[model samples]
Target: MPYLGLIVLVVMIAALIDIVSSDDALVRGLPRWAWLLLVIVLPLVGSVVWFVAGRPVAGFSGRVGRDRPGQASAMGFPEYDHPGRFVPQDPEADAAFLKQVRERAEAQRRQGEIERRRRVERERGQ
Candidate 1:
C-alpha cells in the first residue's frame, strides 16, 4: 500500500509539472484540458502519453526518453531553451502585415477609380 501511494504521488507530481510547463500551442495541437484529463482519470496511461507526446527541448538530441543534456531531468520535463518561443505571436506582426495588405488594396481601388473616371470622360468627349 505504501509503495502504491508513492507511485501515485510520483505520477501526480509528473503530471502537474508536465501540464504547467508544457506549451500546448507550440508542440502538438492538443489542448491542456486533454492532458489534464489523461493524468487525472488515468494515471499509468496518462504518464506514458505525457512522456510520448509532450513538447521536445529546443536543442536536445537523441531519444526523448533519455535524460536531459545539462538541465535537471524531473519526470521527463522538456527543457525549453526559451519558453518565450512558445508565446503567442506578436499582435504587431499581424497588424503590420494586415496594414500592408490594406494599403495595397487601397492603392488598387484608387487606380480603378481613376480608370473609371478616365473612361467616363472619354465617353462624354469633354
Candidate 2:
C-alpha cells in the first residue's frame, strides 16, 4: 500500500526523537551517534533494533542499590537528596538556617492573613 511508506517514515521519526531525547549514560548496545546513523540509514530495521536493544528498561536506574545515593542517608526530602547538593556541614548553622526559614514563612503567612482581613473589611463597608 502507498500508506506503508508514510507509516515507516513516522516510525523512523519517532525513533529518532526517542534516541535524541534519551539520556546518553542510559543508552545500551551502541553509542547514540551510531544508533542515529543506523536509524537514518536503515529506518524500519534500525527502529526495531533501537526499541529492542538500545532502549533503557523501565525502572532500571543503571545503579546498584548500594551505589545509589541516600538509600540509608536520605534527608527525608527527595529533591535535596542528590549527591552533589549543598548541605551545611555545621549542625548549628543548619539549625539556624532552618529557624530563619520558619520565621520568614510565619511572617509571610501573618502578612497574608492581615491583607485578607483588610480586604474583607473594605468589602463589607462598601
Candidate 3:
C-alpha cells in the first residue's frame, strides 16, 4: 500500500515537470496554469487528464517548429538572431541599407551643427 503511494507521487512529479517544461504555444486544451492547478488538486486523475489533454502532441518543436520553413534556422526569429552573428542573405541590400543609415546620420549631424551655431549667435548678440 505504501509503495502505491510512492508510485502516485512519482507520477505526479513527472506530470508537474512535463507541464512546466512544455512550451505555452505547444500546450493544448486548458492553459498551463489551470492544468497545474488541476494536477496539484487531484494528483492521479489530474495527471492522467494532463497527459491526455494538456500535453503537447508529438513533433511539436515550439513556435519555430521544424514544419515551419519561413524561419531560416533554429536560432529563433531572423531579426532577433544574435547580433554580430547575423549573416545577411543579400549583401547588396545590406550595403544599401548601411549607406542610407550613414546618409541620414550625416544630415542629422549637419542640422545639429547649424542649430548650435544659431544658439551661439543668439547668445553673443544678447
Candidate 4:
C-alpha cells in the first residue's frame, strides 16, 4: 500500500515535469495552463490523461517529428538529421557553400555601390 502511494507520487511528479517542460504548441487538447491545473487538481488521473493525450509522441529514438532550428534530438543531445542542420559534412560542399555566400555578399555590395552612385548623380544633377 505504501509502495503504491510512492509509485503514484513518482508518476505524478514525472507527469508534472513533462507537462511543464513540454512545448506549449505541442501539447494537444487543452491549453498548457489548463493542463497544469488539471494535473495539479487531479494528480493520478491527470497524469494518465497527459500521457495518453497531451504528451507529444516520441519519434524514432525519442526525437520529436518536427525539427526546430538548434533544437536537440529526443536523446537530449544534438544530432545532424538533415544536411542543413549543420555545416556540410563534405569539405567540398562546405567550400562551395562559402563561395556562394561570398559571391552573394559581393553582389549585394556592388549593387549598393551602384545605387549610392546613382543617388549621388541624381542629387548633383538637381
Candidate 5:
C-alpha cells in the first residue's frame, strides 16, 4: 500500500506542475475543481490526462529567450487566442503604459512646434 501512496504523491505533483505551468486556455477548458478531483481520486489517470490535454504543447521543448526566465516560448508568443500579449491586471502597469504614450505624444508635439517656429523665422528673415 505504501507503493500506492508514493505513486499518488508523484501523480499529484505532476498534476500540480502541469496546471501551474500551463496557459489559461488549458485551465479554462478543464476547470480547476475537475483537476483537483482527478488528481485526488485517480492519480495515474489524472496525471496522464493532464499530461496529454493539460499541457500547452505536446512535443514543444524549446524555451523562451535566455534573459527571461520561465517564459512560454521564443519571441514571447501568447498562449491564448487574445488580441494582445497577456498582461497582468495591474492599475499601476496600465498607468505606466499611458504615461509612456503621453510622453511620446508630447515629444512629437514639441518637435512640431520647433519646426513651426523655425519656418516662421525663416519667412520673417526673407
Candidate 6:
C-alpha cells in the first residue's frame, strides 16, 4: 500500500512537470490546462492517458518520432533532410566554399576596375 501510494505520487508529479514543461504545439488531444485538470482530478488514469496520447513520442536519441515514413526527425527543420541543406559538416567542404566565395569576389573586383577604366577612357576621348 505504501509502495502504491509512492508510485501514484511519483506519477502525479511527473505528469504535472510534463504538462508544465511541454510545448503547447507538441501536446495533442486536449489543451494544456485541460490536461492539468485531468491529471489533478484523476492522477493515475490521467497520467496514463497523458503519456499514451497527449505527449509527443520521442526516441532514445531525444528526437521526436516522424509523423510518416521518410520524414525528417522533429529535432531539426525538414530542410535539414534535403541534399542541399548547405551544412558544412566537413572542414574541407567549408574551406572549399570559402575559397569559392573569395574567388568570385576577386573576379567581381577585377571586372569593376575594368569597367571603371573603360568609362574613364571614354570620358578622356570625349
Distance from true position, residue 93, model 1, in Å? 13
TM-score of 3: 0.49
For residue 42, give model 4's deviation from the true position in Å: 0.4
Question: Model 4 misses residue 26 by how many Å?
Answer: 0.7
Residue 86 in candidate 2 has what lDDT? 49
Which runs in model 2 stand beyond 4 Å of their true positions?
Answer: 61-126
lDDT of 1 by residue, 1-126 (tens): 769878876987787687877655444436787777777888777767776775444554332222344542222223323333232255466456556776898999999999999999999996
Over the stretch 1-126, how does candidate 5's per-residue lDDT look in tens digits?
A: 769878778878978777766555435447766776776687888877877766555544332222334544213333322423344466476556656776898999999999999999999999
Model 6, poorest ten-residue lDDT window?
Answer: 74-83
Output the worst ten-in-a-row residue range by lDDT, candidate 4: 74-83
Per-model TM-score, in order, reads 0.45, 0.49, 0.49, 0.48, 0.39, 0.47
RMSD per model, one decimal: 12.5, 11.5, 9.0, 7.7, 12.7, 11.4
- Pull out the clashing pairs in model 6: none
Name the regions of candidate 5 deviating beyond 4 angstroms: 27-29, 58-126
* Of candidates 6 and 4, the better by TM-score: 4
After superposition, candidate 6 runs with Cα above 4 Å error: 59-126
Q: Tens digit of lDDT per residue, candidate 6, span 27-63?
A: 7899999999999999999999999999855533433
Q: Any residue pairs clashing in model 4, and if so which?
A: none
lDDT of 3 at 53: 83
Best by TM-score: 3
10 residues in a row with least lDDT, candidate 2: 72-81
